[model samples]
Target: MQGLQQFFTNISQFFEFLVVYYSIILGFCALISVLVLGIIMFLRKTVLADRVFAKAASWGLLILCLFCGKLKLIFETKAGWYTLGRWDLLCAHRIVSIIYIVGIFIFAAYFIYRRRRLHKFVKGLDKATTCSFDNEIRKYPGTISPFCIGCIHPIIVIPEKLDVQNALIVIKHEETHIKLGHLWIIAGYDMVRCLLWPNVFLHIAAKYIKRDLEDVCDAVTMQMNGIDPFDYGESLLANAKEIMLSRKNMKCEEGFLFAWDDNYKVLNKRIHRILERNGYDRKVVLAGGILFIMALIASIFGIKCFSYKRNNPLDISGIYSMTKMDTVVQDTEEKIVTGYDGDYIYIDGAALKEAYPDAEIEEQPLFVFVGGYYKIPGVGGGGGWGEFSASDVKDGVFRIENHDDIDVWNWMIMWL
Candidate 1:
């Protein structure tokens, strides 16, 4: 019990760090992502480029934003055009961390429960005695339209109400989704949706991704099977209009990649794109896309900088400035002693002497750098989301203005 309690304690503590770190950094990355997509969409229309390029860009940015927390390491302290304001109070209490952690677990648990329920339903399904395909094909009695589920031994569940002709079409579509690995993409996107459900920009991206995935599925399905685009579009319209679609499919959790949903808008747009497929050269679109993304990344990431001043405890009673931006206690492997217990960082005397050999360590005022929140009990701890680690023990404090802009770079030009 004690060991279990300690493990949970460690998890809670790490989550506390993550709550601040992820929210701030993700906020910045998401902002840039939305901007990047907007530009790419505009260009797509202007250049007569395929939706695939926009689709790829959306996927790239989605992944980049999720992993961009470590991107701060590569960037130097360069001032930009805008400053992020603080909502440090929202990131204030441990309860917030608990809520964040709980939300994730709830989604995860619910998914697990959903999948088990679905798997059980599939298992209890009468195993096909004489199926035409390698995958198990089962007819389910419900308004929920035909859909695919499972990962290892995949199952395609069709509604019993569908006539033989429409059933084949729907089956072919689901099969295309599986063969082209749309499920894998959907699986990944669903996880992201679960993790960042609170992020509105991500939801915007989600709508695009879902639309694109279907777009890709439709285009590829037609090409591979040589199906008439007109026929496919007509069939798709019929599927979208079917009253058999219901909320039951959502609970099925559309496990893996996707399930047939009653998203009328998605279906309508999909039909339009299908019938109007412009056979653009893939290589040209992809090559141009690469250049566009590189430029977009460079441009969108220009997080503007702003000047900020906060009380510094390390500023004994002398000229203090030029704090090394990288000497953060948590970030750096080097640590002397005496750290911040609250929202401020207390400078250690011995470390101070090491930085300024001439200074009388004992005579220096109690060094307390007040900028970010650090909750180290005995040792000093400090750093907002973008922790302002001050070593004014050397020069002006390199401040990344607002704590929310974790990747924003700052360097002090003068000292007080």
Candidate 2:
């Protein structure tokens, strides 16, 4: 039982490390995405550039999750723990860890419920023969807009009241989504978003990815079918109207829909991109790519730069026979016995003095030496404090160098 307990404890610690690692990476990615988007807007908004930015954000997050373990080790070894101490970093880590674990279960339950609901909804629809794509077409009764459902085996779902021509247009649009495996991307983003629920920036980035995916699908569908951009826009508007008419009955969930009626800005952007003659510019693409690479490099270096090493105080809780080094300032030489008893260090033999009860020994890096302040007991048991330094512990011997007024035979202490 004890061994099993230790095993679980180690597992929990690893997961905590992962939570911290991912949070840092995702937060940095979010800031980068925002800055890139801002620059793109200043230059000019192209569907291609928007798509590239969205892809970068999504794929960057996925890459971070994959390399979380290696990154955690790098952070601990190079960055150090003290660098993160100013922000109550450990408390934030614990909070994020708890939320991450709980969010997984919540999202899992929600996904199962959504799947069951989709199955039940599909059963109530009448299967129709489709001439365009080889997907299963179903007529849905709800006010939800036409959307392609399922990742592996997708189904094109259309509202029952739509005309034959409009239905075909919606079918073509959804089929484009499946052809490009957009559903899989959506699934990946959803999982990452849930896991990093504390990161609002990642959430915004996910929204951008979903929007750009729809725009890309719209552009491809019109170009492939040789359909007039204006006519296609009209079809989207008709679907949006239907969705809005029954908006009160809609249960908003995490899934891909062809038309989101509530988002006028996104709808306008899609229509504008569809109607534009020239698509993505080559120069803009090159610029966006450069910006993305720069951001990635900056994020990596920023993490490394902000980390600092934390020193663990030495555990000097045992007795030792002490001797003071005869320095140029110290004339007397005598052998004294000293011991550290948890909270205080004691000097026994001639010229007895006790440490101020709160003396701390800080171990320097490379195990070179330990140093701290020690107060000597005065008349009526008062405190007279002074700084002290000791050489590295070698062969169970500690050499105290700067003992101030106290002098001993030799300045080396051996563990008793």
Candidate 3:
């Protein structure tokens, strides 16, 4: 439980990181997810035979959404537009962190309860000697028909009744799911739903991704043995009906992937596709796989960076007091009206006007931007000029970092 608590805490921290640094990107992440899912929906049929490609594409999108904030850190373009985390709202961000931590804890408890209950329910499936498939296969007397569960040691649970032919077809369908790695793929979808529960489009995409997984299973199942496509379609409709009726009483929730779904629309599509029984070309599947891979790469090199280059990023246009004074100087109590000439930050309008002599350089508000180095006259913190980026000033206070570095800076500035 403590380890799980730590897991959720880390997740909560990632959540706060996005809110603090990339709030706009956080809002648009959902839209990006929906757009890619739509792309997958369109091209699902062309590459129906290759199950790995579908799963890879789905995982790529999920990873991109979850780690977009981190991407800014990894990529060269750092997050510039921080919506919050100012001195005032920094405290509020901590509060928001606590709130979502509570949310995560509540969901964690609820998921734990469901999992424990599911474990007890699964444990009751007394290995009935109906299907002689394998040792991993567990026979359940429960109403929920055959479904595949687990990533490592995937179990195919066959329920009590069904004709021999239909039963074998059902086993083949689920077996195809296991071999095609659909169980882990569904787990990916569930993670997306669990972490980003607010996104309605993602939940809708889950239904489609799950349907595509089923389609892959169907495509592979027909090729394994000489089962008639019509028979396979009939079995799908029958199993879907059984699962629908069974779901009314007991449904496969939490961890398992139902072999057949009950959605009428998706179910109809699956049945029709099975009737068509089209063949997929190796070159097309290969091309589609490359497309998904390129899309993932594009996300890294393209859409992942949400920040733009800014010469004068920070908007510290108000009066500022010298918060730190390490050197001997006068006028320490004066609040300097800072200004900038484009990217060149300067202070003391009269002093600047005196320096120019020609009066060509006008005094603009000190645009406390990033990466701007300027000679701040009459700054109480130093004797002559202090070489400090305006980025160091938070909430109009220049924080003293590393007293040793300050000593070196003061010595060097005195020479200039």
Candidate 1 local lDDT, residue 290: 79
lDDT of 3 by residue, 1-416 (tens): 99899778866654554343333333334434555566566565455334434653554566676544322332332232242212224324556434444554565576557656755666667765556454266666545567767677766677667667777898888888887777776766666665555467666766666656677677778866767899999987776777776666555552153434455775786688788876556578769878887887787666435433311123322222233322212222223324333224444534323432322221321222111222211111221223343333233423222112223343333333
**Separate clash counts for every candidate:** 15, 5, 3
What lDDT would candidate 3 get against the real structure? Answer: 0.52
Tell me the TM-score of each prediction against the true structure: 0.56, 0.54, 0.58
Candidate 3 residue 69 Cα shift, in angstroms, is 3.4
Note the Cα lDDT for every prediction shown: 0.51, 0.51, 0.52
Pick the winner on lDDT between candidates 2 and 3: 3
Pairs of residues clashing in candidate 2: 79-307, 79-308, 323-410, 334-408, 334-409
Q: What is every candidate's alpha-carbon RMSD to the true fold?
A: 11.6, 13.0, 11.4
Expressed as tens digits, the lDDT of each residue in 192-302 for candidate 1 is 656655555655655556566666677766766677888888776665545334434445433233345436665666677888876556577558777877865764354
Q: What's the lDDT for residue 383 in model 3?
A: 18
What is the alpha-carbon RMSD of candidate 3 to the true structure? 11.4
Better of 1 and 2 by TM-score: 1
User: Could you give the candidate ranking by TM-score, starting with the highest?
Assistant: 3, 1, 2
- lDDT of residue 411 for candidate 2: 17
